[model samples]
Target chain A: MTDESMTNGTMTKSQRIGEIVETSTTGFVAVSKTLHQPPALGSLVKVQLGGEDYAYGVVAFGTTVSPDPGRRAVPRASDEVYDEAVYARQPQLTRVLHTEFSVVLVGCFEDGSIRQHLPPHPPRLHYDVHECTSDEVRRFSERLVYFRLLLDAQGQVPAEQLLAAHIRQVYRARGHDAAWLERAARQVTSLLRDDYDRMMTVLYGIEP
Target chain B: MARKRLGVVTDGAFNAGLTVRLDPGVSTEEMRIGEFVVVEGEGNRYFSLISDMQLRATDAALLADPPREASPFIAQALRGTTTYATVQVKPMLMMPRGADTDFLVDLEPPQPVRTIPMHFAELHEATESDFGAVFGHEDRTHFAMGKPLTMDIPICINLARLVERSNGVFGQSGTGKSFLVRLLLCGVIESGLAVNLVFDMHDEYAFGKESEDGVFVKGLKHLFGSKLLVYSLDEKAQARGGRGVDVTLQIGLNQIEAEDVLLLAEELNLRATAEANVGLLTDAYGADWLSRFLAMSPTDISAFCEQYGAHEGSLSALQRNLKRIERRPYVVPEAPFSVIDEMVAALDKGQHVILHFGRYDHPLDHMLVANVVTRRVRHLYREKVERYEQTQSPADKPRPLMITIEEAHKFLNPAVSRQTIFGVIARELRKYHVTLTVVDQRPSGIDSEVLSQLGTRITGKLTDERDIEAVLTGVSGRSFLRGTLESLDTREQVLLMGHAVPMPIVVQTRKYDEVFYAALGAGEKRSAQLDIVELFGE
Candidate 1:
């Protein structure tokens, strides 16, 4: 698919996954349109800020909670009613329990090439988050500098597991580029020098 | 193979040498001690030797708990980054980088390392040109001794510098010390830099002898023919169908001096009083003392001792020791027409002489004969040198002479080095146009003063620490070279150091097989034609 948007400067509606609910320089929280589902953990997602400028992030954490902080949802499913069937039974439950995921700002695509660093500005609130195309994932993973940001990200999910899952996703997106996998592993190894235990943990977690 | 980048200089000192951290791709297993290396600094290139190596890790815990055997990826990633190898390179010499051309290099020779390469200088496996530039190429004055330990390039030694002073060849028995000495003799003969007087104790250098591999290796006589002369001390053995002998060496009893007997005090089991009695006997009987003392009965010795104011017991013991020299077949009361004069005349005419001991290979026999012959030759050389100084005529000048002696410690130990002719030649350098090539297994037994005066020392593997220390006496940067010397291969490898080489190096000695025979035989033919032209005045 073409990286450039139509004349409207917006991604197609089918490609949209969520809208930015809260924004910060380092990260943002996006609420998914589907109930109890945010983008798969560590998957690449992007938000466009008009024209060809876009901000990128890796899905760091996900949770489904009540819309209000004070509100608590009561147990309503029985032995026969669970999973999708229970969700189908309670139509209003989907609206009350919103699914939101946190995204750590990795880099941005501005001017012409992908910059493997934090965006110049935080993406505006309420902007649509889109699932990047296979070509974008291949292009972005080419420069692995952003690996440091993911490794240093502070979140409930351990950094090693988060980076490993993201690499697995990118590996598949890039049609199983084995050479790139080794380069990515070596890059992480160099950054974690002297931290032998942590380096091994990441290396073992990312084994193809 | 192409020259490979091995590592980078990370840490070191001028005295201790530089520490090089291996590059991410280079393997530690491939680095060998005594191998040559070059460090490319900002403006200079330092030629060095790999003296030591160590394996290091970024974290101690990584060594304690290495990656599991099943996980190759963790091991591979940790190899060049977290855990790596470092080699200790002893920088021997340094030269500026722009002196790449041969003409420029000759103009600016490498100097002893006074400073270390800067931190992080690139290190590489030494190339052939590096060996050529440092050790020089084979020519009239330089002889290709051997190749460096890990390279195919020949490492040359300056024959002119080698013959300028006394030299040594040392190693334990069967470590190829004799083979190395033979190669050196061939080089000296081929270069025609100096004439040689070899005391061949085992009869190996004169006539071809069977090697350990059952192959008959050719000797100097076979290669040089008429240009070399073989003198046999055992006429009977020479008569038993062997290579032709030019002369039968016979030492008249009257020719044996008191100094020659005193030099063999230990070999003949003489006491302190023997020295004083020998002096009295020499003062009384002059040059005929050895024969007269041997002819005396116990009563006659007592009468002579009483009249000469010498102890009768010392004189009796001296007579007993004198008997051992008289029993040798070559020793006689008189005749044989001044054999010393003949050998000296041969040496003066630019012919190499090898005095094969034949059956008298015992240390006592070798010691007595070598000392007697060398003393007389040394005296003749001294007179010739004095005559040349007085007359200032080219005809009176003495030709340069190199005396090669095996079991050198017997004549050069602390007790006799001050009086033996070999020790005197060693200390005098080339003053009387005389030098010595001492070959021995127990260099430790050699006097420290004499050992220090050695110009070039080619040593094979030595197991004795004291012998090693003695060989390296008075040498600079000896501690670093000790490791290289100790790491030498047991056969055909030697550590060449001192005046003859620009820097200390370990080399795989050239083989003394048919290939060497071919090289020497060719040189002999050229010299032979020149000799014929000179004789005919064409």
Candidate 2:
């Protein structure tokens, strides 16, 4: 899912996740309040940029941690037996722990045309990020060529798993067209006929 | 006028051929094995045959090392990322047009894989005009044989290579070897460039036969009409009911020479002394030897042998071997007229002949007549060729003849190759404007040298590794075509390669129907199409 096609005025205030904290040629780091759930892993997200355009990336990972690891402290009250009860007593833990997610830049979309490459410039710091809407993901998948760029992405991430998850998310985003899935499978088969084992493994992973 | 790019040359050093990687979004189904493709390099178009294909993902090696068990979600995302089709091509020749004229007039020498540039130059699926330009669409050297497996265009082969050298058709039984040979003969005859002498062992070529499916198949005589004549030896009664038989062919015993007798040495099991004695008897009794010599009783033979200074065992063995010939109903002391002479005359006037074996389909009878007749035809063609070379006159030129030998291995086997007339023709008859199309199931049985000499080979499905190896002997890129050869459907799918075709191609052999006959313009309508007298207002 991607919100590249969604308008700025239409996005509800509640959809705001956080601000872009750091950026690089490959991806960006985002910091948000612990309140909102991290966008589903492998889901497309749009980071607001210096320009009017949105920089797109797949949510590779998400985590929450204390602001200062050196100043860590944990105290289990004698009467408290669960983390929920302990968190209810120590409300300041919310202020200490912050949610942050990292995303690999897959492509950029402006005027509803998807460009599967690094954006001309990184999104300006502190810009808000939003989960991609289903409409946006559907619009991006009409050609399915961006799948090439995503597959070609360089990272330590499990490419096969990431690819499968992204496809599953997009497949649902596009109304679960079995025909499209089969066509995609044919392409994969053509490329990997010799590696019968891997083809099978990859194909098995594609099944929902 | 830009043509579509089939693919681009991928990175690989080519010694005899090169591989091309399909571009993004290019489907693998668009091309087929054995179809012709061209590579653009250094301002020239280089032609090649699609030998094989290899398809695999780019990270196949990585995938091999304990792939992370990912769900279908991962598979969907990874689609088309590194997967691609690689087309392995065997380069044949380049068609070079003059830089100034932009017209390709001269044929480039067929030199393969000398220099393959690494520029990843674009390649294109060979068009109909491209195939026509290389294989020819002209009246002199063209005859449509079949259509390309992928395209709707008809395939034509070079007639010069076909008539200038011998050819072979090989396949397992019921693979339509006869149908393929019939189609090939039609092409040869339709061109009016060569005459055919088919030794029809099954009696099918003279008259149509009810196929295994009960469909009546038309023989060559039915298609070519008066141009084709059927000469039956022992099949006179049944062949007469059919329309094609022109002569009740009868071979005189005098026509069987020493060499003719030697062709049946395996069947007759002639010993060295007996075989030598048969020649001696021919020399003494002369041309009438077989009739008079075989008629001699044991008492007369012993007395004659003592007078003629011959060994009893040798003469007796010769007499015993001659007994088989006496039993054949077609053999006579002397026929009213010689069938060999009649055949030579008809061929001289550019008519084709099919010798239907009929009930005489036994190896002995078929070999004897075919051997005797073809030996005479070879001598006749040699003298004509000699005369034409000396006189330099059009009338002295001999009409090219192609002898079609069915069940070719039975006569051109390794043991008989050194002695048989068919073997001699396969070796040296091309110079005399005579060639042979040896059709057989067991290519492994044919002599290796004879097999190599065959200028073209049209092969159907063959499962035997030895037979496949024999068929692919001396064939370039044979390793690459193994799958296509072994996997061909058992019917009309045939892989035609060697000199006749521009490159190796697996064709869905053309159907023999009205459209095919009409394509030949009902046998050379070129001369009748125009008259110079009318142009002169005469």
Candidate 3:
């Protein structure tokens, strides 16, 4: 193809991309090749931007449309259908993506194309990292957050996963900075070993 | 005219005597035990009865010259001189019966001694024999006798009369009121004239010295063989193999009318809608409804109400009311229903029923049971009395059902007059041969109206003047015994002042230590011991 034609096509593609981004940010999704539906806020989906795949993004807000028929509209699709596709992909991604993303959903473009958006900045992670000190503390806290989120998503998570994440976080944060790493390590190890103790204590027919 | 010489004895041995010439009007009967007399040669002297007659004369010359200057001839002459004179005697004076008399005598020359009469003083001396004869071994005889039915002091006269006539007891704490009641119970049981039903609050009267065996058990066992029915409202009974006697306790809400239930609900501070719903449920279910109501699952009852288009609030209210009723220990299933029914049945059979409510924690439960039982007995008694008044029968002389409530103030107090069954029994039971024997520490706490109706008053040694005053208001004030009531000590009770006993007399009461000792402290300790045994197997 001629450079001029290629540039024109690229501009058209860029314009289409701009419209998609604008509609997505406005909480709308394209339902068909040419039509759009008003977006439902809190809908989740995946979006591709700058050649990297972002697995989940939530529809944070929906913009009011002008009544004029000439104005191009954005699209919105149901979340139930989107969830099926999302679940079929890497199942572990459900945990990571659910905690990281505000919403997960699917959408169709005007040219019969599909697109996804997964917002990079998860609000919950931001809240946690805001109070973090050293990189080790931040990283450890992130792992702890990840395990907690996983447990929340699954209803019941393995005790080992919780203990491992907890110990790693503590070790990374306090190994060098702590005055007594060996003692702290021993205590943390003992605590991790008795991961199931508290739960058992609560449920072992001991009345509240 | 003649002068008569008379001799008066001073000492029993006649060691010294007085001789005097009588004034003619003096009589021998007029001569007093202690009087002054003078002989012709003797000086003035006092003499008293050694005997009625017999005198050893003293020398008048010795008195005249003070012995130091007396001539031997004059002294001999004074000793031997017995000059005769004309004698005179006065007419005998008459004295009234039961009256005391005093007299004075005077001796002088030429006539018999003159006598003067005076009024006599009355004296009362109580002896140990009197105390020993009335108090008995228990030291609670005065209480048992129910004598001295007065308000001034605690004497056994009123109590004995009260028990004999109306058959009731009253007092205040530390006033030996319970001790009096124990005495009264012994009296009633011993009299063989009437039967007793004791509502023993605090469970004091329930158990004897034998911890495991109690008066309640013994009485029940006597009435119902080895199977003494006991109903416990402890949660431990719900556990497997708990040590509680199994009996059916069906509480009939229908026994009380809707208005009455509402009134009770209002009094209890229950929700209006709940009260209304309970009233409706009770009306629908009738007397046996409580059984079905308790048997129904909570969810089922809720669903049933919903099916009938009842609001959730009303349904919830009904459930709450049921729960409130169920929460009472007495209302728990496996309670002694049959025992109560048997007691009622025994009343119908003209047999006496004694409910020994030994040391129980909830005095109100005793009151409640008293209320229910009294209500039922009163109803039956009314029917019988009415029937008898219409047509007299040999078997129908007021069935003679006596209800003896220990710690009566707890139930029949005017302050918390909740119209319990006991209140009805107290008010109306008397007319139908159902007499109430209200026993309590504080007689002042008992309702005056009920207290007044108790024709017989049994008063024991009451230290509280107020309680004594409360009791004394029920008796006649005309008797001389009223004045002496204050002098009465413990175990010396005034009896039969009320209509029951013909006369007020101090009588000794029989001892029933088994029943009395059981009524001492709160009965909860026994139940606690039983609880420990069941819970810890100790």
Candidate 4:
């Protein structure tokens, strides 16, 4: 259950959609789908920061609708809007994944564009958006593959592989050029490896 | 022919019949009662009396048979009128072994048929000389009778006699008192009729060691071998320290009466108000009052008493009394503390038990041992009586348990004793088949009432006048011989004569070998010296 509803406070976009995933000080992926925005909330998004690929996260919360005429008009969908047509197109989708993913809230700029808040060190890093049919998201969430892997591995991922995958996926999905992706990946790989290695070792012991 | 003398048989064995011809020279007055007479055809010489005489006319027809042989001379003797004189013929006239005595009387005589008074006479003489010769034989010897008569004659009559009644052995020191006691106990055990318990005070009765002959020697050996359970108060005291305390002090004071406290105070001579306050406290707070009193500071309970002017000293005295009472020691037999209950259980199962308290210290230790034993015996008897009454069956024969208390005077003290365990035994043990065999040197020191209750008294020689007097008074008159009372030497005892002995007799006590008697007074002085040495040595 969302903290807003539990504590009798005004509902946030993520809380209106589903439960909130509270995070510790450590970085974690946010669910960004089934939230305030329709296609964006329902989409699978890859965030490449410091040349490291984080596992898929759904659109958790949509940006507030802007009154400015230059901003693109995003679909104004309630909880019932995705009932038949969206679900019929995604047969493998289940309600638990929608509920789990829908609680995440993504940041937005005042101009009503998605914010570019990637880690500054890897300047060429980009966001990759995959229009995850409800089936894919449901299958991913249901498998809890990455969560199980993180738990089994005690919360550590290989730095070089993660950075390479992140850059490649972001470039492919956002139609970014391979040259910039390769250069960014190359530069950040070594540094990310060291940083990730040190951070993971300190946070979770080296055995994991 | 002369008138014939008549003859009649007297004793059956003297079967000879005598026909004494009436001769004028003889007279009938010389005949006697026990004279032997002889007659023809009788086997032996017979003595006769002229029982009856009659004169009748001659009947010629009755004389049918002719005389087998011609009759001998008719010798006539003068007798009174109607005289049919009896005369036993001489033994030479008999035919042989089987001849019968016969007498012939002639109706007509050559002189005249004159009647004379009848007389019976023996044909042969039996004189005083004959008697002396037959009965008196100089070579024979007479059997010797028992000892000379005395007041203890009755006691001797019952010597080695089984006494089912409880007996007590009492006397003063140097009286060979324990010797007498040991003799009585050995008698009872040897009789194989009764089981006995000896509350051995000095351990004198404890049996061990051997004789030269290797007779599995006696003393208390039988008791020890049997179900005897020895409870040594001295050992207990040593094991527990002199501070051996009875746990009964923990019994709730609520169960105790005000009178009990008063009696206890009176025994200890505590102040009256203290006793009263004890009762009051006991009544108010119950058993925990002592703990509560102890919890109070100043070690005094009077301050806590709401009553005004109930003296503090009395209260302090009461506190001291309470502490002493709490410290009174007890002997917990392998069985339960209730001796009578344990005894009854043992008795009901026909178990023989010996409670040996041989190693106890002097006085109070003796008292405690006596008390425990007597209490158990009395309890068993009472239980049996109750059971008999309830069942109304003849099957219940209340078998008595013999409880022997050595050094009895210490525990059975009459003048000053109050509510002691031994006192109960002394008073009520008889009804329960609990017979007390009190063995003590100072018989006078024991209570008169308790001494009176002892049925059989086996008194050894008593030197002390007072102890002898106590014993004399306790024993019945029949048992007290004049000289025996004043001066009975050692090892010589007048037995029975008390309530316990059915008969009074003086008996030479069977001597036990020196080893058994040596146990008494052996270590006492040496132990005292050793104790002193240890105390000074430290």
Candidate 5:
């Protein structure tokens, strides 16, 4: 977004990428500000409730469709105008189609401390959602209690794939810390101790 | 080695021992049986031995459809979490952890484990100080036997307890049984806790013998000098070359008795009537029965049997057996001194004696001579003990004596053990100040009663199951020790158990080399200094 939003302990209007459309204690649904676009899948995103109190989640599932189920859009373009020119010709199409993503609630930041558990209350309706800064990712990944939530997610994305993606994102944001990655892998292993197939799937996905 | 962190206590029982879950960094291949380990409990520290190991996985599905071959990623990830190793620990002793551990006033000794450690107690490799605390440091009464399997510190044995009752040293052939016996004899002589009368059947104890490595090892004479005496039976065989022969032993025919013949029924191949026939001869001829019976002709034998109402066949069989003893070069008819009495006198003066069987190494010669000499010595010891008890005089009290014999099975088998002098001494439990040091290769051949009565057992490698069972006859935790005993290294390792040590331990026996010689020298100097202090009334 903007340089100001990337600074520590500060948030800016330019960094707001989505708004909450639905809310619950376990997860929430959000709509991107732009049409037919969502933040990269499995990215860390947080919603500020009030002063120094925020709720965090990881992207689990995403989709794009017309706003109304009763009305379907029919094909109106010929071979000469099938690319971006069709988007320019029918400007109203952008307003009708929207991008939506499902999030799994992992942890919360409350009273000046990062708690790796669900928030006391879900984020308010229509709150602004922003991508987590690199400092937030490093501090949150130091403890891996949130991995259990991601592994237990019952969303469209496979739980193993979602967990692996979150681990890789935090690994890169923490300057490629190999020791931290090994510890995180071991934590995952201990959690899925009885489920060897899922453990192997996650370990193979997050190699290096 | 430094005390290393091995694992934690997961589950176990008081009788079955403890189960330790190995740490992620510790591999199963690095753990070994008989290695000592320490466990930190809630309020105490436990000394345990590694008895077994196992590799386990959390899920059975992992074994059914395993990961792809050569996939290091899957193998490394599953190494410690899903699949891990566990060690079976047999906790033997426990020491309290607190201010009482200070050794200034009185050392806090390790007690037998009455309870198991708490859950998740951390286990570590035992250090040298742990060994010194459990098995005491070497001093006047405690002699250094060897070191533990993993450390270089000396594991001393309580020599005073060792001499209080009968002891055994057992192993198979070529497993250093002789070396261990020699080391023990050296300790006995140096400490002077008891006087040794060794019936050296192989002549390996008096004069130095060549070791299996082709190096010459010194015997008791080389170490004790004037304090030891060597007596040989074969004077002509003395040309083979050694030093120090204080007496050329010759047993007068009158010195031999009918009991000696009865003890050799198996070696002499006598029938069942031989015992009754020998009794008739001893009753008719009194103390000179053996010499008189050997000199009889066929007519004299028939006349004696008819007069005594004894079986003719049995009388003839007795004569045949008596001829074997008469043919021995050491046996004489009527012209020699009482060497058996002189041998007893030497033992009474606290000078150790070794009766070497120079060239007469047959079982018949060994059995007959050992039984005869030991019987006389036992009688004298019994009379002295009785006189000392009646008068309560210090001068009348006899010096403690330990009779060492090799091929112990020949003298201690179930059929003959009840009549033999060695068995009597073993059962008496130092009552008359006489005990036995039995060295044998086949312990199963010995009586189970005598085996159970042994005070301390220093055992080397034995592959036979019955032999192992016999050695561990009445010992506690026998099932655990069976595995440890069977896995001993064939060369320089032994499992020492019973009264001599605090608990059962596997030791890498100290090599009988220059290092041990130097240690012996240092021990002599220390004891000499103590003697001086006592003389000056310290």
Candidate 6:
């Protein structure tokens, strides 16, 4: 079936977040000039350059790094002082530091269909990145094939953790339908029969 | 254009098997072990049976990671991300050149599938045509033994493949081996494929036996109608006070052979000297020797033995063994019914016979009568084979005869297999239009050679590992089927395999109700049935 049908024709303009800074065939790194908080480690991220043409990816790794290579010393606000207070206290830090997260390219919505693999080309430079609409994530996840890409991904963060974070973000996005949650949990047991601890952790992530 | 897309193949060793990452909508309950499924590949569809299953996270590490308690956010994170179900399938058949074709050719020769199609779908549960092709069409002789565990598809067994050689019905006690044999016999009678002469030791097959709950279970005669002619010693009829006897069979001393008396040595507890003389006496006095030898006086016996070059002590010992048979009232010098001639005549007219023990259900009585009747039946069948061979015409060939012997190990045990006629029939009676349906509880006790020769085996629950292994003797894939047989339900369910069925399968035995009797294609079911519906309606 076509992605148009899969989206149920409800996909509108998604929330623009950042711009692409570095890219590769399997994954890419993007930097937002200032961010309240980085997108959760494994949330779905989209990079679209034009109409109906986009690359979909999972947030495999995320961190806030200073933009300039020299002078790596960055100010830190202690836990007692929260986001608004830290921003007020260190205005200079915001211009120097940017929240950067890496994305493992999972699939593409190209030629009007959802493709569960690396797209033919990387998104053009400086293309606006967005948090896929809840409906878009739901449609992309109707089949869980993309998780295989996340599992196959080789990155600094553990695939299991990234997978756990991805499921959590999707669950929060999709209204947390209990039946769907139960079904997804069942799917977890099937894929993780061995290595009980890892399965337990994954189950732990989905326990609500 | 339309089908339930099950999954996509991935991450499997092409040589070992195929692994399917199931689709999200497909639940865990669908992929069962031993279930048949069809994999859609390029230019062909492969038929496979699921052997093993697993569910796990995409990352191996996530499976064991825990804080002992699940975090709500973490739990939702794990839901659709890392977890999936995979089924391990062993491909059995491949319809090469097209995915839609139903011809099931072998998947052997080890063709390497370096990659699958872009449109590869893991598999869906096999359709009816797929199962029908694999199990074969049910013809007149093709009756379903039971339904497969995956679905309600009947597992049909070809009786022709079965009756061509010896067969065995084996299970532990109360495992419904008798009922399985009864169903098989019904198939045999319905197809008119063979005539069965059952030597009923428990007398349960010819006459209904009372269940523990005080219900009377119908016997084979009721289901078979006129097709089954029953022969008994008339003791049960006498006890029933003129309830009637179908054919009063009296095994007079005239029908006793020297071999029959020799078979009784163990039960009679006679010395080996007596067995030696019994063999000599058969050569000396011939077929009617039992009564003749018993008639001799002690002095006359010694004189006759001395003249015949036999030991005097041995002759007296043989005389002692002679008394066990001489004392039985049923073994008269003559009887109204001749067991051998009547059996041959009934078989010639295409009638199945059941020889009941009446009051003499002892091992000794059963063995003696079985030895006598089967011996004569074997000889008659051999004669008919000779006539057919000489005539070289299908019309001259006698109808195939299958003899049902309960407590088979007694007659076909390793030690007795060397000495008994039943053992030879068990091993070497595929030809001569004769076969045997040997029933026993401890199949381990039967001769391994005879057990291996069985063409079809219908076994219920057997707890003993040796009994289970012994049942799987000649069959292939012993290791694969061990768990299945070990877990059999100890009731009407049975594991039927061998020449009859297309594959090893467990089936819930068909009910022996009015429908069963009706399926036999006979007239009214016999008088033994309790018609609750008729009584209530009236």
Q: In terms of lDDT, which candidate is strongest?
A: 1
TM-score of predicted chain B, candidate 5: 0.94
True-structure RMSD, every candidate: 3.1, 6.4, 49.9, 58.3, 3.6, 7.7
Q: Per-residue lDDT for A44-104 in model 1, tens only? A: 9988866777888999999989979899888888999987888899888887899999999
Worst 10 residues of 4 chain B by lDDT: B73-82
Model 3 chain B, TM?
0.51
Candidate 5: list runs displaced more than 4 Å.
Answer: A1-16, A33-37, A67-97, B1-3, B68-70, B99-107, B237-242, B334-338, B528-538
Q: After superposition, how far is residue B359 of candidate 2 from its true place, in Å?
A: 2.0
Question: Given candidate 6, what's the lDDT at residue B337?
Answer: 37
CAPRI-style grade of the A/B interface in model 6 = incorrect
Q: Could you give candidate 2's per-residue lDDT for residues B124-231 as a string of tens digits?
A: 777765666566664556666777776777777787778888999999999988878888888887766788999999876767766666767777888777778888
Pick the winner on TM-score between candidates 2 and 4.
Answer: 2
* Runs with alpha carbons beyond 4 Å of true place in candidate 2: A1-208, B1-8, B20-35, B38-44, B55-87, B95-113, B119-130, B138-140, B242-244, B307-309, B336-338, B518-538
Instruction: Looking at model 3, give its docking quality level.
Output: incorrect
DockQ of model 1 vs. true complex: 0.58
Complex DockQ per candidate: 0.58, 0.12, 0.00, 0.00, 0.66, 0.19
Q: Alpha-carbon error at B283 in model 3, in Å?
A: 5.3
**Whose TM-score is higher: candidate 2's or candidate 6's?**
2
Judge the docking of candidate 1 as incorrect, acceptable, medium or high: medium
Error of 2 at A151 (Å): 12
- List ranges where model 4 is wrong by over 4 Å: A1-208, B1-166, B190-195, B207-224, B234-300, B307-311, B321-340, B350-352, B394-396, B416-418, B421-429, B474-482, B492-495, B499-503, B513-538
Docking class for model 5 is medium
For candidate 4, the per-residue lDDT at B461 reads 64
lDDT of 3 by residue, B254-332 (tens): 3433433443443345565755565556666776555566576768677767765556666655556655555664454
Record all residue pairs in model 1 with backbone atoms less than 3 Å apart, i.e. clashing: none
lDDT of 2 by residue, A1-208 (tens): 3343355554433266767888886788788745446777778888765444667888777777665757655675666456677678778877777778878887776655577777877776777777777877766556555555555666556655666667677778778977777665655554455565656554676676
lDDT of 5 by residue, B1-538 (tens): 3568988999999989999999877897786687888897988889888988889888888888777662665577677778888999999899886553434225478999988888999999887777877888888778888888777889999999999889999999888998898889888877878889998898788877789999998887787776788888888655556577888888778877777788888888888888888888889999888888888998998899789998887788778877888898888886444676777777776678988898899999898888878888888889989999999999788889989999999989998899888888888889999999999999999999999999999999999999999999878899989999999999989999998888899998988877887877777777766644532446
**Which scores better on lDDT, 3 or 6?**
6
Clashing residue pairs for model 5 = none
Candidates sorted by lDDT, descending order?
A: 1, 5, 2, 6, 4, 3
- Residue B229 in model 5: shift from native, Å? 1.6
